[model samples]
Target: MFTRIGRFVVRRPWLVVVAWLIAAVALTALSPKLESTTDQTEFLPSHYESVQVSDLEKRAFPGQEDQPAAIAVFQRADGGAFTDADKADIQKVATGLQAKHYAHLTKIQADPAAVSPDGKIGLAQIYADNKDLSDTTVTENVKQLRVDVKELLSGTSLKIGTTGPAASALDAQESGDNTDAMIMMATLLLIVVLLGIIFRSPLIALMPVVLITLVYLTANGLIATAAKVFGLDADPSSSTMLIVVLFGVGTDYLLFLLFRYREFLRAGMEPRPAMAEAVARVGETIASAAGAVVVAFLALTLSTMGMLRSMGPSLAISVAVSAIAGVTLVPAVFALLGRGAFWPSKAWKREPKNALAQRIGAMTARRPGLVAIVSGGLLVALALGALGFKADFDMGGSQPKNLESVQAMDDLQKGFSAGKAQPTQVFLENTGGGKLAQDQLAAFRDKIAGVAGVAQVSPAQPSADGTVAQYSVSLAYNPMEDKALDLVDGALRDQAHAAAPDGTRALVGGTTAVLADIRTAVERDYSVVFPVAGLAIMIILGLLLRSVVAPWFLMISVGLGFAGTLGATVWLFQGVKGANGVLFSLPVLVYLFVVAIGTDYNILMVARLREEIRDGNDPREAIKHAVARSAPTMGAAAVILAGTFGVLMLADNSMLQQMGFAVAFGILLTAFVMALFLVPATTTLLGRRAWWPGLKEQAPNPAGEEPVLVGSGRTSG
Candidate 1:
């Protein structure tokens, strides 16, 4: 099948090249203008308590504006109350915001309670004009409001500072931008230096940078299209990840193809034929490796977190696009470049001693069972960590501490209840035509306070029309903690609703409620996303390998890799690190990166195995031959890829560390164990029957083509 494909591509190389160029141009042009949301509330279903509460607020207070996403907090240097002149200046700033018609900003309140304690600080509650505060227009309004506030406060005794959702978001954006720039520059330098060292050719080193840029543009366009067609949500973090995956993983794929291409060229094949045969021989492996990664990313759909679920499709789409580019775009471009692709370096025409890979390969070939047992046993032991896995959904905690929002949260936690930063609100609304008495509301608050897990209940704040009253309920644990989420969504909410007056309705909202909703969204995503991704991967595998049997077990092996990675993470973070729990989204991320990228090695190994078998070698010979030839490429690629992810451990955040460990470790395990030991051993045991439906045939070698096995063995491929 691959031989036929090679012939077809070689015969009409121009056609393949043109098709990719045209597709790249068209897709790049038609790519949608995508926007990502970091708004935690947006991911929740409207039926969830937080969403319902939000909806009820809008309905009950039809003309009321939501709170401004940001606020300019003004304070006197002397810690004194604002003078009438200071008040007037603030009012002028507020009046300008009103003139601008900021979405969700109805009016600004210069009320005294809006001020902080010690009479030094004061706040203007900038009520917005619309419900959706994340709109671009709203962002612009906030920007203008800042300008106006600065102008109004000019030369005044008060010092103004903005600190709220918008301000914090802007700060985060700046930090992320800085991080992105630094990471990109660092990654670029790393890849160039590493590749340059490896190939000893500037042209060869620069190829990945150029190729991956096109891959990035193409993948992004396709991902945007997929998101538009399927209604997938992307987060702010997606761009950083996309860049890394495209360059990092794309480089790995390119290395895989190049290594094989170089080997073929050294064997005396001319440039064009060597390139063609290279793609033909390694194409299935590249496709399969990509398929495994795609499947693993798609498995993120099975995550019970909206962030993970949404991230699943976004990343899967990127991988799929990269995979397509790997086979079609990469091969076509290389085909056009021919031997000159290695300009100034005739190293491709020579062979390396490669004593290390050869020795390891010889050992594995000699003692396949022992190799398999030791490697497989190590993964099994690490898998035990998964039993202690716990989930933490603390979004606020993930935010950097330098931000005012985070600092304010800490201050609020210290001064008041920890829940003051984000309290759980229980709302009781009038269900009957008649309004309930104040006593009924008080009684409901009492009942809610007495419920299990409640720390305290603040005095009820009545709605403008008095049809609804909101009571803030504090909990003993972080709102994102499983126990707190369970408390809010389980007994507390249920009990509050049950005990509500017949004429009144009840709903829970705020941080805990939002968390509960997020959990539900994640659960729904897990059910929908994982299956689609897996099916897509299987289809790609089946197409590449032309065998139904091969794709299934490959996926199963990758799945085990995922489990082992997660379990290892649990042990490291939960047991060793002494943390509350691993991030709720960690498992999904590990599954996506590890399973997907890990599969690349498997695909490379398996495809080589098949190629060996197709050349009329028995399964045992194929396994030995495949491992000997492919192990070096796989090891090199895995080291580079794993090293990239390993840098995430340098991050200050625990979440990034967990991700770094899981993905890096998983890649090593996948390459060393699953791909090298398990796959080869299983195939060796299966022998000729493994390639069922495509029986082994001792066909004559093509004219002028000498059979080349990895170390002079009668291996497959």
Candidate 2:
């Protein structure tokens, strides 16, 4: 089947190229504007008490003032107090910024106490009317406001900087943008250098770049169309993530095929036939791997958070596209490049000794049990990190201390109750027919204020309709703290609701409430999304491998990988690092990337195993041959991917660093242990049974060519 595809593509290279071109051009043109949300609240469902209260607040108090989007904090350069003239200048600065009419900022406030304790720093509250912080326009506006504010602060004695929810969000966005650029550039350069080194051909090095570019454009276009048709809400992080997956995973898949093609050619086959045979042999693995990744990402649909929900579809779309490109565009390009793809280095004509890979394969073949036990133990040790996982919902703490937003938050936390800086609002709604009296409201406030975690309760005010009363409750801790969430949902909210007068009900809304809702949303999503993604991935695996048994274990291996990765991240960030909490969004992010991409390696190795099995080798011999042949490519690909993600750890944000480590570590484990060691070893132990209902039952190579299988000795069984 792969041979037929190879022949068709080679025979009609121009047709193949043109087809891909048409798809790429059309998709790129039709692609919708990708969007993302930095506002953690926006990711939560509207049904949570927090979301409900927020809605009530908006409806009750139209254009209600809350936290400022960006607080332009100003201070004297030499650490001096603000003069009356300095205050006047600060006012002028605020006025000047407002006059600019930056779309992101609806209002700006310059107050004296907006200053720091040393009398050095002052602040301007830049307000946006947005209830949803994750909106693309809002974040972009915040970024633009930062720039505008910077210009306004020039020439003033005050060394002014901005910090607030909006500013922190903007910083994260910019950091991700910068990080993506560096990672992509680094990955591309590495690929170019590595491919050039391996194949000794610049043309070969450029092949993936050229091919993946087309695949990405086309895939993005298709995703836009799918999103438009299905009404999928695209997240901002999707675009950057898609870029990495396509280039990173796409390059790996291409390399897998090319290496095999080169091998066949060295055995004296013509370029067209060799390419076709190579694709035939390896296509199943690429497709299966892609399927697994797609499934894992799709599992995110089961996530409760809108961010993860949105991210699942976005990443799934990307991996699916890469898979198609791996099978189609890569082979077509190789067909066109022919022997010239490996030009400048006649190395393609002769096989290297490959002493290192051969030695590893020989060892595994000699002692599959020792290999399995040792590799599994390493993953297990790392898996211990899972025990210490903590979830941090604090946006301010996520960034570096040097960031103006982080410093400002720190300052705010010192002066006021961390809760006062961001308070939880509880709305007592008249769910019944009539309004309640002031006494009832006062009684409710007293009860809420008395709750265990409550630090202070502001006086309650009646809603515009006079049917609802809003009370602001400050906590002793930051709003994102677990204790805060517990206060709102457990003791505080329960007491508030319990104390509500007849004909009235209570709803809690704030950052903590939002996070609680997001957590619920994620749980619901897990049940729905994980199974669907798993089933879809299995179907893909089934079709590619023509075996039911393989996909089941593949899912299990990938599933274990997810758990181990999460466990490790928790240990590192929360246990050892003593972080207040891991990023609340880490689990979802890990599920989407680690599981999906991990499946990519699984498919690669498994497909190669199947190929060897069909080539007249025993199960043990087939496992050894498959590992020997596929490990180098799979390992190379994993290293590149891990290295690219590892760059994310350099980010000043704890969230990004955790995400980087988890993903990089997961990829390494998948490639080295699961794909190279466990998968092959397990399949070998399963023997002909592994491919039951498939063709492995047929005699190994009916033609009886005495193939030189790589291993024959050790089996766990």
Candidate 3:
């Protein structure tokens, strides 16, 4: 099957290339705009309490839908108490901003009652006509608000800063834009330089970049089209993630085929036939490795959160596109290039010494048990850090510190309640369809105020028809903190429900409530996604190796690698850096990338080991030979992919930096420690038993060695 595909693609390179171009262009033209959703409510199912509250609020309090989108924090420029003139300037700034008629901002007002008791600070609330922060108009309004406010307050002693949902959304979008550019440029540069260094050919270095970029556009178009057609929830992070995955995954698969092509080239085969043979030989392994990645990602369909569920299809699409391009487009391009793929780099025509890889292989072969114990022990030691891992739900905490939204929040907190900017709302509904008495509403408000974290509760404002009453509750803690989440999730929610008057039901709704529910959803997803992805990946390995036994230990090694990676990240971000918690999605990201994609190396090495054994060499000789032959390829690929992600450390956002570290370190660990040391060592020790029922190969020669097939020990770089 793979041979036929190879011949077809190699024989008709132009047809293959033309088809990709046409598909990419047409799909891109037809694709709809993919809106980035930061709203947590959109990620939840309607069955959750938080989602239900949001729905009820919209229905019962339609007039209140257009709330303040941002808060303009004002203070005297010299850090003194605001004089009457400064107060007048603050009001002037608000009125001027409002008069501009920004796209989403409907009104901007400075209320006399909003000034601090010490007269050191004042507040001007900015109201938006719509609530969707992801809407482009919201960003434009926020940008213009900043500009207008600065110009409006020029000669006065007043200074202003903006903080609120709309401002944060604008900042997040800018941060994402900046980080996306750096990641793309850095990833491309890393791939080009590393591939150039490894293969000594500019042609070979740039080929994967060219092919993957086309695949990226095609995959992106398909993802957007799928979301539009199926109404899938597309999160803000998915697009940025897609770019990184395509380049990293595509480059790995490209190396797999290129090394095989080089092997055939050295065997004196013609360029086109050699290219076909490379695809024929390595195609199944590439496909199976990609299958593991795809299934692991698709398993996210089981996630309860729409964020993960929708992200599943988008990422899975990119990997599938990359796999197809690996076997088809890649081979097609290389077939046309022929020996010119290597260009001036005649090193492709010579066998590498591979001395270091040989020494490492020999050491493993000589003492398989010790090698296994040492490598396995290191991973276990690091795995201990996983116990200390803490999940942070405060999404705002990870944004760049220099962002205007963050700085504004700091200023606002000095004179106002930390949670004043966005307080939780308690909605008491008359489920029996009767009006609630004022005294009963007051009693419920008192009950909510008695909760430990509730600092204040406003008077109940009954809806026009009086079927629902809303009370705003301000917490002592920041709304984004875990303390707030705990307060809202546990005592506050339970107390609200239990304390409601007869014929009434109380529902808590706000940022902390949404985050608490997300925590529950994420916990549920872990139980579902990990087991399903693991089982699915194990099945793929079993099929690829034709050995059930190999799959078991392979998965065990992958699990250990996952734990170690998590542990190391916990130590770095949580322990050493004193972060209150790591990003909630870190574990899922590590598992999908490290456990699923990292298996590519294990598959490559073990497959080579199986091949060497089938050639009638001793088991130890095969381990040594396999390790020696596969190491350079694995090392080069790992370095390139790891470096691609490590560049995220340059980002100002804490989440991006942490994400970059975890994946980069995990890939290096999988390649250098697990694949190179543990896997080969364990296979050496397992000997023919590793193949189990499929072990029909010639038994190891106990008395002496027999020379294997021609060129069995030669190395290709």
Which candidate tops lDDT? Answer: 3
Q: Any runs in candidate 2 off by more than 4 Å, and if so which?
A: 38-42, 63-67, 72-107, 110-125, 130-160, 523-556, 693-717
Clashes of 2: 17
> What tens digits encode model 1's per-residue C-alpha lDDT throughout 1-717?
455555556567789767866777788899887777875666665566788888787766676656546555665656477687776666666665567665545676665454444444555655556555555566556666667766666677776655555555655666567666665776677788888878888877787788777767777788888888888777877776776777779888888878877877677666556666676667677666776676767676565555665776777677777766666667667777777778778776666766765666566666777876776677777788888887778755666677654654453343334554356878889976466688898899889989877878988877777888878787866676788899988998898889899878899987688888787676566566656666777777677666777777777777778778888888887888787888776765676677667778877887777777777666666666777788878887887788767766655456766777788899998998888787777666566655665554556657876433324233123
lDDT of 2 by residue, 1-717 (tens): 454566677678788889989888877876776554555555666667776776787787786644456667666777577788788889998998789876656888787666555565566777787766545566788777667767776777776666666677767767767767876777678778777877789998877777877887888888888777887776766766677777877877787777777777777677777777677667767766777777777777666677777777777787788877777777787787778877788877776676776677767777877877787777677777766766777766776777666776775565456775567888887887477688888888888888877888989878767888888788987887788777777887778778887778888887778877776666676567667766877787778778989888777777777778888888777778888878777766676677667777887777767767776788777776777777778878888778767766766767778888988988898888788887776676677777777865334422543322223222100
Shift of residue 447 alpha carbon in model 3, Å: 1.1
lDDT of 1: 0.71
Per-model lDDT: 0.71, 0.74, 0.87
TM-score-best of 1 and 3: 3
Better of 2 and 3 by TM-score: 3
Query: What TM-score would every model get versus the actual structure?
Result: 0.83, 0.88, 0.96
Ranking by lDDT: 3, 2, 1
Best by TM-score: 3
